[model samples]
Target: MSAASLPGVRLWTGRVLEDLRAGRSCLCLLPRTPAGGADAAAVLDELLHELGDFVLLPAPGPADAAAPRGAGLPGPPAAAAPPPGGPWTDTAPVLDYDDGLSAFGVGPRGGGPVPSDAASAAGRDTPAAHGPAGGGEPGPSAAGRAPERGRPTAHDLADRVLKELGAAAPGADSGPAAGVDGLLHRLTDGSGAASRVVVVRGWHEPVPAAAAELLRRLAAAVKAAGLPPERRPRLLVLAGPSGLAAELPEQVARDDVAVHWWWGVHGRLDTATVVAMARPPAAGRAARHQLLEAVAQATVVEVCGPFLDLAERLAAEWDGSPDTLPPQLRRLLCDEGLLPGVPDPDDAARTVPAPRGPAPGAALPAPAGALREHWDRGLADRWDGRLRHWPGAAARRDPRTQETGAPVWDWEWEHGVRTRIWLAQNTALLPLLDEAREAFTEVIRSRSRLPLPDLAARYGPRRDGVPGPRPGTAAAPGSAAALAGMELGDMWRAHIQGDARLSQPEADRLRTLWRSRNSLSHREALDSPRLEGLADHLTR
Candidate 1:
């Protein structure tokens, strides 16, 4: 499919064009796209191929990459991984000027007036939907500058760029030629044709302290320089969450610099649109609906390839039949077989027989081909078939059996809960830990004999202003706890108490621990050793 057709690409293109038209610098905050989905690199490639009159710059290494870390916000953590290079290099510059915006010219720093009326007239006449044309040939060679001498700093690049634009003499040090200020002055001075833009790629990686400082200086210069509207070259900063607002001193300061965030597929692209693109036309409405929901719930990385593969298999297996598959692939793997229904303490229904598979019409296609890779990763971590599952995957596996199909229904509630908690330890923050616990609670809820709605009500939120009952207090008829107000802590305790595998003392500790979750705040640093101990207690 053409890049322009994808929803993600369209959203990206719109933003870039908006920035160019306004003659303002852009600071586009990029998110990591799933493995098979649209990404910033793809968008940039499309722009280079079609858009004219822009210069692309590589990231100044980690040293020059830093921006202000927001107050009390976490420092730039490491990026998950570096992006792979394809047809384009993040450092290369692509210049094209088919649009009127390209007619911008720059005067020298401290130079007076728009250089010429011709440049201004051309910019005013440029059309917004200027069709794709090759970036016109470089006058002074945009490529091959500062190569053998090593990549230049932002300051040096800005200086070199001005020299290329003919705004300054080759060795001129107008006001010491310090930063991007010189380049900005030239672009605004009317020395070039139309307003120019410099796209700074690869800010997706963590920004180091020095680079942060360089950006601060540049921002200050931009603010103070007072370049006219026509000469102001847009500087687009493309980065991930950590790198998002790092160019600014605080979150509020982000307003002055355009900050666009990527909120995964749900926000950046339409769910129905993504589904339509991934599945065949014959795929049923129900399958498409399920795929949309699954994509939302799936742990996003990039547009996940495994997910697309699974969707294809599901559609092919159904083949226009009326068979309805389970909406979620992850849920299907863990909940459908081995474990059966969750054992309810007050009721005699403990181990319901596992159906040979999912209920007849709702069965999911087997995890084969692309699906198996994710499934295998979801299963044994050690891969020796000893059933070593990650925290997220552990909750779904049958705690009672070995990987080779040996029966060992000696699974204890504490052990299962402990494995889930193990997953929690890997997370960097508290809210995520709470999410992992909630997933475990939901897994058990799905297997209960009680209707899904009733279980949900019993476990739903407490009424506004109604305080939680003291941990051990008896429920009053009209009190919040009595009106189906049992929180996750309560539901978890009840489940733990009914399992004989956990002694009363262990159960009490576990319940107390569950309630303790409320004490942790989102911003609070996790005490790993302390949480790990709780996991140990569960196993013991």
Candidate 2:
């Protein structure tokens, strides 16, 4: 499937385009994983292709070992020759713009001013004549300047930007170079009628301190420029692994830079969308639905590429067989305890039956498929054979055995199942839980007559408005301060339920949410009924 067609891609790209059109430059953070990186690139490329005028640039590398750190300028050349095809090499220019127009509809060639007639007709001064609204002297155009002999510097970057935009390069005759500030002037000064975009790819790689500093300056300049959306140039930095943002200087990493996650917000794929992508070719609708349910239940992170690979493997191995269970599905069922293991034929023959007429009751539910039939028969025969040899086996074999006494639950099995369910669904569940908590907190703040400050003093961690010890630190077990730090669950139980001003129905609604919140916190997943109830209450 086309990456642009994906729901996540569509949603993310729309926001990115909106940012660009509004004249706000973007910092699109890609996932660090290989598959994630490729997908993110595809998504970004598709958006750039649609928007139509972007220059793709390779990220710069460190100049030399002795290069000054975070200086925001290029260091002197080292004695040894720089590696061939490296960012420093003249053979490979920093900016790639040749295919920008033909293939991706980006990086339009000329940056000359709008025609005189067009400007006069529009009743506005020619952009080149008046210069950019934000005043700054234009630096000597860096046009045709040989790339600095050593490692590429911020100066090289500026020159490349100028060249790609068709602005003049900083030659010896053009006067002192304006560097990045000059590049910004060229971009915003309205020297070009067409919208310009500069994209730095592979930014997830380790960025030199100087380059990082240069990026900070560029972003700061763009933000402070205050040009209209149409006039400002778009700057996009595509980097990875979500955590890469921390490595950026504080200025560039701030809220001013628009960060968009290619993977869903938490690096997890949407369950329903992933299941749909896994649909097997040539399967009946009912069978497909059942298979999707199994896949959805089994998946944890549901990474797009890996899950699709597994699905392809399933299709190849199954080969349209309807009677036998697919090996992949069988493995999933065995792991999830939905299917019983094959029994020993010798044991089945040796043990005698209890001779009691079939115990009158409805049979247990099983998944649909021929494999399920085989499993049911094997299970029944195994139990029947053991019944006569083992005392109380018949009682234990009853599906409704729990009704007669306290159920003998396997704590390990229960824990394993709960853990799997939580892993599969937590991405969706956690956000909903957060929203519900916020809503409930607002209810208490607005409706309850209790004094907010007093409530915090009584139940919050900091009694005197002073910060407490870091979370999970050792504190006196019985101290009032130590026992403080009430979570949503605790707040609902200790205070909301007891509030006289709150009505019973409202309290009950909050109680349901509290239960759901507690279950999730404990790494347990709620069943559909409870999940639905939580959503309904929150929506109301």
Strongest candidate by TM-score: 2
For lDDT, the strongest prediction is 2
Off-target runs (Cα >4 Å) in candidate 1 are: 2-4, 33-36, 48-51, 59-152, 157-160, 163-174, 178-181, 203-218, 242-256, 264-269, 277-540
How do the residues 1-540 of candidate 2 rate in per-residue lDDT, one tens digit apiece?
543465545655777777777666666644333222124445655877877867766533443233332211122234323334343222212221122221121211223222233323322122332234475542112222122323344555665666666665444233323455467666656666227677765332333322433455555555566666667666766654221334342235444455553322212343244445544544345544443344343442221222332333333443322122223444443343434332344544224332332222211111122222222222221111122111111111224553211125333333443454565556555676676666556556555455655554444455356544325747553333443444566557545456425568877887887887788777776665675566567556
Q: Considering summed lDDT, which 10 consecutive residues are worst modelled in model 1?
A: 140-149
| Cα-based lDDT at residue 79, candidate 1 | 42
Backbone N/Cα/C clashes per model = 33, 10
Model 2 regions more than 4 Å off: 34-38, 58-149, 176-178, 203-211, 223-225, 241-250, 254-256, 262-269, 281-540
The lDDT values for all models are 0.37, 0.44
TM-score of 1: 0.38
